[model samples]
Target: MQTDKVLLEILNNRFSAIVNEMGYIVYRTGFTVFVKETQDYGVGLVAPTGELFAYPQEVGVANMLGMPMEDAIATIPEYRPGDVIITNDPYTTGGMCTHLPDIHLYKPFFYKGELICFLWDFIHSSDVGGLVPGSIAPSAYDIYQEGLIIPPRKLYREGKLDQELLDMILANCRIPEQNWGDLKALLAALNTGERRLTEVIERYGVETVKQGITDLLAYGEQSARAIIADIPDGTYTFSDYVEGDVTTQIPLRIKLALTVQGSDMYLDFTGTDPQIRAAFNVPTFGKTHHWLTVGLVTFLRTKNPSIPLNKGILRPVHTTVPSGTLLNPVPPASCGIRYATAIRVIDVTFGALSQAIDDVVPAAGAGQVAIVLISMPDYQSGGYKVSVLQPMQGGSGGRPVKDGIDGGDFSAGFLRNIPTEMLEADIPILVHKYMFPDDTLPAGQFRGGLGVDFRFQVFTPHCIVTARGMERHRFRPWGRKGGSAGTRALTKVNPGTEQEQNIGIIDILKLEPYDLVQIMTPCGGGYGDPLDRDPDKVLKDVEDEFITREAAESEYGVVIRNGRVDQAQTEALRHRLQTSRILKPFDYGSEREEYEWLWPPEVQD
Candidate 1:
């Protein structure tokens, strides 16, 4: 506590409030539902050195806390009051704009003729004009097909909107008006940040405000270091694979060797598969980017729930994502589906860390977040309407002491599912079912959370459906310490109909009138052995229809008869099953077990 602890706490709260209010303004004023409801946006204040110094804890995208601004800011010739720079080029921005669909805006905050800080924010535009309607397709071969790539440019000059530039950008997009409104909303948020920062300066004076920013960052760094020092120092290695690339059925491997020494951690992704032709590459620019370090960030947060959300937390994290690898791909490699690779990165990081501190980490979660988009012709307007059906996700992994959360993943836990009413009102679709399925969770002492089954029918003819980030079809979420693996994902078209089709995993699909689409995401991996589970819990699960009597008996060795647990029979069954069961440290599903047997880790290394 180099700075006054009381003052640092006060300043931290005030700065966080400023960014949260900025996010609120954008959420209320933005045009698209993605921004207004789903909140696919972020707002923060950056230091002159480019790292975020202040960020909202409870607003916008939760994982975008460490986006760098120095490279993008350097591209600007000079900054004046009210000048805003905009860019969506991932390569040019040094990974600040991760994907083209994410349009980033930065405004320099000036006070007393000096640049004190910067307001940085961005929103995921609904449509940015590309090969697909939503500007993102898992099959995109390169960056050219993803969407518009805007290099760092002066979007606003000298407190005035660059109308020509803005109009040019809008004209190239499918939803011109919506994009324009979202951009305006971003500007409003930046203005809010500017005003609030100015007020803080006026009240506390510029020197104190600057000192406060420095002190807060230092505090965050100290807190992160303390947490990291607690972990046992050692090198741990782990590897995971993407089921397949969009262009080919060959699985892509992601490898990591994490070394922890004192309070410093180094992540090496040397043996990972090279960048594929599809849009799954992550452009990290070989820096310690957010995607490469989010797992460590999550770990720090879990260790210290009161840790500040800033770039200081990443101070001790060092990374080596070799160029041409999936984690650090070269230019021309499509990055529209980078999140697909990022999810695996999170899982692999967890896998490596779990070896060091097994009890602190949970088993593998349902490691995918899919956004279903529907586009069809609007007869009244004679134009197409694009709307997000839902940002669907699966369940988190079972923890050491408790069950996983149902229908939610820990990686993007902040994102909210679209309500059925909202979907029906905006899109021409009928929601028939949206609920958790029974018998899908992995059986364990602390059972995994249940996955979701969403069934809907499209009323509009010739509607196009695209689901991005669909994963875990072949490989199930792995369980640890004798727990069972979770279920696999599935997709169906016209299920239970005469013309039924099994669309196992898809990037884009076409639908006719009355066509039903059902998406069933995977459940999370369980923790501990099923036989170790309490008989009472198994009885409750059966009564609630979460598990069938057969599942309760077979999976957990619990004997249930006529809705009541037979205690003596349950004890006998548990004893018999435990004697026959063979436990393993990691329970990867059969698919992975067979795949690994063919392509062993030693061979890959």
Candidate 2:
């Protein structure tokens, strides 16, 4: 029996590899830049119980894993040999779609009439039919403006494409051709899942294959439990805020409380803010859903990349995101930019977990960074051209073990900025400057990483630039323990010039020729005491141009004279600075944080 269990675990990992390969195929073959470059998609193999048994490592959006495949299966009961169910519905599919832009598809696999598994994939389509080009707006207030809400329906009936549904979807979006290409790519990925699954069943009998899933989840549960157990069991709570709902101009709060007992951990989110009418609400259907857990999973991945991606990882943990809250919004509550709040939730979770397991968790990171879309009519092509003038992101705060990585990737691990050459080729724009912003990173023993700065000149006569979910502007990512706070975000036109205006939380910007657009991202928070930093490291940073001599004297109390460290002067300054500085907990966005005014941290705890 034990041998069978071990074999099942091994087979589970093998099948997981197959799904990962399938994910890569979808990414490589997809047409959209969002799919090809940013990799904003997910691939999973659902078990007989309708839960995901295997998910992709490269794919980072893990919250949608529990989205009920059973509801989708029942919606199209006429499941023949080859049929795929596709939908992006928030209500009918049980919060699977959450918003209209994401296109989701699933197909069941069978062996001798016995249903074995379901293949699932979803991608954030560039555009969907709506009042706005992106298929989301805070002002819209209703589902009608949010674009097409696809309920669970058969996209392929008996291996043949459903032409009517395809036509309807294509007619609604601005980029139909590109969307169709992505759909075909996803279909190919699902085919890969089917092929790989067939081999698993053949190699280790169908019964064993099913049992392997259960055992793998068990193993993950054990591993996650062990990780949780190491932290001294206690209840730690924290809360954070987003700028506001674009429509109401009211700030939103996300609350969390972490409870640990032995190997079991529970995340309670009870005092969170009420769900807004805006598109920023999180649609996590309660439980230890992916939105709140993926960051922890990302951190866990750094330690154990071999752990299986199954519901079992959630076994040692649980969540309580309330309905109509920021973490769990209701229908027609615009969730188009929901990931913004999700990133903060991840940050707060780390904040709370840091209390129990300081070494395992990391300091605050640049929350969520985004590039706005600017569009205009191209005279040469007589077509609308889109421009991503700048790819924005915040610096990663220094970790307990090491210095933070500069200009790090967002929540989606695979997200990478498009090269200047590619951006220029795709749009009518000239790249002026793209480099790390100086004097922005927080300084400490292990200095925080610096954020990016990008400046562009619009060549077009008229262009529309829209930005949403740009946080860390009013407040910065806070460090933990003795670390320091990070720098805030900023955006403007010719920042140092006379026309400079603080363009914060922009809905849209109309641009004219020779308009210089500048975006400065948030810097990472510094960890540990600055005085403890090695003088050699500070000198090196000065040489690397990551830090300035003025910063070394002011922030680190390190005095440098004639390009050399003045040991006696530095020692006296460090001693005085260390004694004078107050040893207080790092301030995240708390001064801007409203506790009872919105949601309580324990609400989601």
Candidate 3:
């Protein structure tokens, strides 16, 4: 190795620090709720070839660590000193920009007329010109309907802001001023990265720092390979489903086969459904793209705590995703809800890995991250004004030794909660119920985490509500080791009222003044048998109002009186429950049991 190990470690920390500083600039200065609150943004330093060489460790969207930048960079063959490029076209950039609302911008960093690296980041704008507010609709049929597409172009040339380009971009958006504010935030982060990297170069000398980058990438590959080598070499298979997209009642399947031979792994996505007409098709370009293999990145990071966060981590990983499938769709296929598929992709990745090492993996989480947004008429500007309400996420899956998280899952766990002020800040949506549901006594010995039951009333004359990425309605998360399945998701209008109506998966619903809407996200899967759970813990749950007294007795076989335990009754009920019937290792609710009964996993394979 050209660089010493200690020096490489030092460089890794320095690069990560620069990215962290950049991330902070975005969060603090960002304009919309999704940015400052939902944290649907990312910042990092990329190699000249467009792959991330150094990224933030614990800030912003972590799954984007493997985002490919080669195609995006190649579009602009030549770059002047102080040049910055921008794009939101998922197809042209090879999925670097997964959706249109996520505007990706990058600035080239040059050292003595030599290209050192690129400072890159993206922000999910509140609205871009589209079929609805927030530039996303689960029922949208084509990419064009989702939002404005900014093909790879120079937003800044030689540090000169392209005012014309900026004007054209804002022209199509529903809320131009707010999106402009976000663009300015992205620009601020890039400037911060430039100054920081310049300081790094001054301290370490350009040649040495350059050598360190090469060595750091190599170290990342070595560390990642070591993580793979630790897992037992074998072939494992697991499959999961994405319940009914906007077009069909048929659930889309995501099948994975993990072939582990020595320090290399090959993932084959065969027997999966073809691209749908809806907005959830993943645009991975048939490669081991970021969204395709991000679950492994999570697994790898956990396995080797100090592995360098860079593109090199994917060095030992390979994939074969068939073109025109859910994972690798052709251009113009609606992909605004691709994260819905990404959530399932991550689940199936662990599903296959669990077969390899059942004891290490947790049961599945809620399996859905539904984002709620509203668009109302802007009377002042004679345009529509869009605002984010909240990102509704169910709890994480139950681990071998612990219960699932209450209201946040591992898939989108890093995102911060939307402040109450933000939810009612720009819009007239009053928060009615934004708390977790009363427990229905979850499935496992280590029970799944609870989910939210959000209800809001709109005060505007007329409004359009869009809740994309909704899932787990028909098929809830499955449990492991005799655990029961997690509860299903549901959406309602004026719930429990004379005008009550069930609106499971929505494109965009028109709401009148004083109209109420209710949404409940699915919960995480359980790890083990409910009978195996501690009785005292069940009693504690009842005391906390997490579960009803009836649920305690029926689900957990626990008898309580006057907020305390009834030992004798509990013992008899538990004994009766134990003798009832044998339970399967995986309990996939009655719905999925019926689903598999008719079609079967064998035929899907």
Candidate 4:
């Protein structure tokens, strides 16, 4: 038996509202810009079983939807009313606390001396004692290089702060004060969640709220399956890549064989390449991890926008995450840049899904997030300062009926762009051209989103810049139907000058004073054929400066004369272009096409 359908929805919204409030509290009270500006944090309510019953949907990072908390919660079996657990060790917490930079914490909620639930939260705190500034380096060879690993332990005990534990953690960070500030903000947010949840428990009665948790989870499972069952039941397979590691040209390949049978979907990654020494490992603990199942989540959410966001959504999804693969790496493997591999996993997962439901799926979005990080020495205090210069993101892929969002990628749509004034106030840099390039992919019916145009000049000497998640350079985002691929990411130093140098996908760049770096992120891939695009839409793009007049004529087969459509010329151009070549449903650009021709997916193990 279950609670009334209407009552369950009311309870769901109540729980969701609490977590969203928790997230907003953190954002308002946080000391770090990563929390205040980018909203790179997560908070949720967890049942005693450790599965998240409620998660913040409107605020914070939505990537941890399916993150398993059973292992992390089991560490400290006996928890008092005010006791809390803190961890950032991926290995120790069964990948629950993925990566060291993401400092995670959870506090038990008690009602009438009985533990009712737990409120969990995490912030992507900058500089957790790593070899690099932001504690993330794609070139990182091992976990030790990433940062300090705090196993699941008591951050607070018996309503008391563990000063020793706190000291040990803050001692290892580059910006200890800022991290402590963020920790306080998390604590404040958790308190907010506890208070809100307590009010609901008080109003609805403890038993009802407790049962509501169980009922809501089942409801979530049902809702997700309802959406997923709509997807055609079949086996679809696809593979994609992360450019390469620091030392090797062999790219990190993520493969997926998606099998949809009724309401359930099984993701088999048996043939994925072995994990590398770099920080690209996903560390999923050889199960269906949240990081691995993001593509399926996107599908469910996109297909059924009203589907509840909770652990129940994962009930209908399972995975065969083979050990030693990029998705499930062994211990000591560098997993700091695990998100890089996960994004590619999302791509392959979508790749397989597109074969099943082509019209429902959009073309690829900006498959990367290049967050500009800077670590410099403070001249006044003679201390070190680490800060995020900006999070430059690519655009989302063009959809069937709508254009992709400019400067917003599906992977990072939740995160907000940091203001130029704020970044300059903290760092010795002048941000210029922090806007969208007035151009888009000539997708068939709609244009793909225009990615960010982030350019800045560093004024402080020997300032280290680490732009992690810089991808889509070699292989661009693939277009669906007859649409063309999006543009590739480009990094140029002193453009249009004698000192111009188009430096490709960077790792950690060191700059002298007054060094200007311009990073133009890749746009999303388009859907359908360019020639099939509405001419008025093409002209609007021209008037809006989204595409050049010459490009409108050349790419979209839309010729214009004196601001009006050249009907005769347009017809002839479209005809010539249409009959020129047989269009492939997917346009993966030249690099992907050439590489696949040499090493095909069908032939691979």
Candidate 5:
């Protein structure tokens, strides 16, 4: 064992740098805008045991830190120096690749006939053949409708590309040329990893490099356990719900009972609702999946960001997602939009942890990643021109110390929005308006973040629009302490015109030329009492147009007059509001309260 801490640290940094460099290579060389612009990809260095030993933190997908590759690797018969395995089937890959659109590739690195490590990378391809143009639809009832499911198989053999396999895979996709280019980019990244790992092995002996990997994992485990030990030992239970499944109007509940004891913790999702017929199922494979425990990893990162992000962080925590539930669904259940339910898992985790340590966790966030895709006839080209207009998301929750980030959702922080110029240039669309709405945020001592209001017009005729992962339209994001719940989402068509129409929670919409589409995202929940907010902060918010004068006075209990704070009136109003307020652990807004009244938690379970 390598007991030298300095040597291990040096090896760790070197290995991390290799993967980080590989990620940048993919980003720069990728052909599609999805990879180059949004960066919906991940790169990591995996051990022979299939656990991630070193992962890139600066680039690539942030939530794929603890993804295990054992199940996918074991399916292969043998491994050679230049052989690679490719898969995107969630069940066959053991949840390593959650959806089919994300193409995962793995290549083994050999050091003098001995296996050193495996290079792993995945990119969200722009289009895979399916019912919808984007290969994802909220109404999809089975996996077949999502896209093509590729099982673990050899994509390359003995440094040679499998032409037959490559051709077949590309033929099934809608955009064959683009998919082939992105696959090559992934191969380039894997090649970079191989060269870098070989150089490291040459400098330090293979044995020393292997020992350093073990030591780094141990260090991460130790750090994670130490942080977990700080929380008081207890079991905390919390429950939250998705507004509705795709096929049904009834809300689906996700329940969690988090048990923390000493340096170990266990999360049980036994009481969760059954899997829906829609595409909201999460394929966890009944293990400690990354999506089930990402909140803990995020919490640890917030406490000590210096810790290397790898699978070791998951050692101290365990998860139990019951079969037939939304988190762990059986085969044939569609998981096209699993990210929507994954965000709720994060919220429920935060809700449970807050009961154990109130000050550490934040309130509920706008828990959805609304993806808007537009497909129109391409007159220049023979086929249709399909492109993603925007992957719109809401804001983060308010913290005890500071206000939540405005117009920034934590769920898809890594996926950036396409630039306006690029969208207009590539597609027949015009961005009429894109800005935060005034007074839409929930009020508190540290108010919730503001949400976005986006309006655009289609310049092309016979355009079809599809929006997936829409939430917070009915039940709002709940607040904590005396803070208020955030606003809900809304969608409209041709607003301010005589032909204006309201489309509430739509799966797809057909449009003609000059048809306007407006999408309003939800905000995060606030933390602490609204009356405790500073008057100056309220005045500044009013001036910035994030909040109106009426909301500053009514919701926050802060009085503003002549563009300034009325200190005496504010103090009196705050005192009165504080006296009348009834504090609750959670404030789920009136909409949820009304729904819960009819269908209580106990009855649902």
Candidate 6:
């Protein structure tokens, strides 16, 4: 007989607490800045069959749901009760750890000599011995250059740490002590999950606990199906582009054609660009994978905050990924910086769904990671030191209901910029300005938020600043339903100087004493018609220096006189704009026309 619904939900809620408690122990005992402050980690409980049973909803990384443990478990059949398996291989882990920087650990939970569940955890280590200190670079061409890829092995056997394996890992990375601290903390976190999970089994009986996993997964499946069933059944296609290849100026195209029939959805990625030589390939293994649906997942997680975390939540969705494309690349394709392409995947998905849900979808966003890497050479140390100088990002696209968040990281939500003080203390860099751009927001009924304009000057003579995945230079973030496109991003060296350079995309330059690096991050696109916007809001933008008076007159059809909007002139201008008989659709720019041609239905498949 099945248990009561209330009891099942209560146990599920308690199971969530157990995982959260597990995540906290890692943060409390971990030693690295990544785990302690930045908190780039995750924890969860797995059924004996390797399906996810319980996950931390509020905390922990949300993207680890696709990780596969059955293969790893098969690779090592014999395991004691306290034995723990460790791996960082992207292919071996079944896309669990997307890259080598994220080290994954799993411990078997046994009840009377039979394995009942698996306690799983992962943390992005500070460094693994590679061409770069952080084990990630746009320049790296393959997985080999990224770092060491550990196969599934016992990190701990019978509750005792494997000294040889630990030594091998510590010796390969630059920060041994910090890595060890993080590893120990992970083990401790798993132990917490183990203790609480065993207690659950003891109280409810193993059979009931096993049945709870099935109940929770089925609940999530029902919720997801209900959401998809509301959308009209039809085929919708959309496409977007990455800024460019790191080694080339040609923009990489990513296409998506979504078909929603009944409660099922399918995403086809046949016309996407061939994989590049650089590090921008997604390693999803081509399921309704996490990389392809992070935006929708975030939306669902936010809306249904209490939904259970399991594979069934994603059962309503499926994907068709072509080999050698940016979404699913063949071997030797560098994948260290795959998140750049991941952003385009999300944007394309939204583009496909716009036809079905105009109000639910907004416009395009700054679809690139504003990554900046800085390195300093110390003569006394005799080696180069590296640090991420503000993992900065721009705003998201404005929604139909409201404006996007200003100076926000889109896909990697909850990840923040490293503090200026931390950068100054750890690395040799001076931060002069870190604030929102003065007049970067796009104009509409709902204006897109502005991006951060960070100014930094190098103090060290032998320092270098390199960056990748910047967009909105040649093409702007496009708006929808008569809204205006957002302003483009700019990267320049020493404004007003005759020798200043306007860098478009992907550059590695040496820094001098007086050299400055200024990044004007991209703004999000607006929603609805600008002519329909409030006159007072347009006046405020002009007065507050968010947009120029000329911009209001030209784009929004609102006239300003003596620091205020002229009501009579604005009314006349709005009328003129409405009757202008413009031939251009709202998405009129390089971003739309190019992708439209590249991903036509005939060319697909």
TM-score on alpha carbons, each prediction: 0.98, 0.93, 0.97, 0.97, 0.98, 0.92
Model 5: per-residue Cα lDDT over 369-469, one tens digit each:
78788888878766778777777888778888999888876667777888888888878799998888876768888888878899999978889888777
Kindly list the per-residue Cα lDDT of model 2 for residues 205-246, writing each as its tens digit.
888887777777677777777777777878998877787466
How do all the candidates rank in terms of lDDT, highest first? 1, 3, 4, 5, 6, 2
Kindly indicate the candidate among 1 and 4 with the higher lDDT.
1
Instruction: Report the error of model 6 at residue 116, Å.
Output: 2.5
- Give residue 72's error in model 6 in angstroms: 3.4
> Per-residue error at 578 for model 5, in Å?
1.4
Model 1, span 1-605: residue lDDT tens: 45578877888888999999999999899998878888889999999889898888887988876676778888887899879998999988888988898999999999978999899999998888889889888889999998888999989898888989988898878788889999999999999889989988888788888888888887888898898798899999998888637679777899999999998889999999999889889998878888888777888888888999999888888889889889888999998878878888998998899999887788888888887888999899887799888777888888888888999988777777888998798887999999998767688888887789999999888899987788898899988888889888999999998989989777789999999999999898998898989899989988888888999989999998887889999999999998997987789989999998998889977
Cα TM-score of candidate 4: 0.97
lDDT of 3 by residue, 1-605 (tens): 69988887888889999999999899999998889888889999998877788888767888897798888888897988878898899999987988888998999999889999889999988888898888898888999999899999998999888999999999998888889999999999999899999999999899988888877778888888887887899988888899748677789999998999889999999878999999989988877689988789988887777788998888788989999999999988989989989999999998888878777677888888888888888788888878878888998888888888989888888877797876787676788988988865476788888888899998887799998788899997888877778889999999988999999977789999888999999888888878788888888888877788888888888998887888999989989999997887777889988989999898877
The better-scoring model by TM-score among 2 and 5 is 5
lDDT of 6 by residue, 1-605 (tens): 26679988888887889999998998789876667666678899887666677777666566666455566667777879889999988777556656788898999889888777788898877677776667777767888888888988998889888899989988898677778889989999998888898888899888888778777777877888877787799998876667656577666777788899998888888888888877788877776677888766665565576667776677688889987778877776667777778877777777777778776776777766656777667677675575667666777777787777788745655555778888778777778899987766687677877778988888788776756466666677777776677777888877668878876664566778878878887887787878878888888878777888888887788998887779998999888878874523255366656755775545644
lDDT of 1 at 112: 78
Question: What C-alpha root-mean-square deviation, in Å, does candidate 5 show against the real structure?
Answer: 1.3
lDDT scores in order: 0.87, 0.75, 0.86, 0.86, 0.85, 0.76
Candidate 1 clash pair list: none
Tell me how far the alpha carbon of residue 29 in candidate 2 is from the true structure, in angstroms, after superposition. 1.2
Badly placed stretches (over 4 Å) of model 5 are none
The lDDT leader among the candidates is 1
**TM-score-based ranking:** 1, 5, 4, 3, 2, 6
Which portions of model 6 miss their true places by more than 4 Å?
Answer: 302-305, 378-384, 466-468, 507-509, 561-564, 581-588, 591-605
Candidate 1, lDDT over the whole model:
0.87
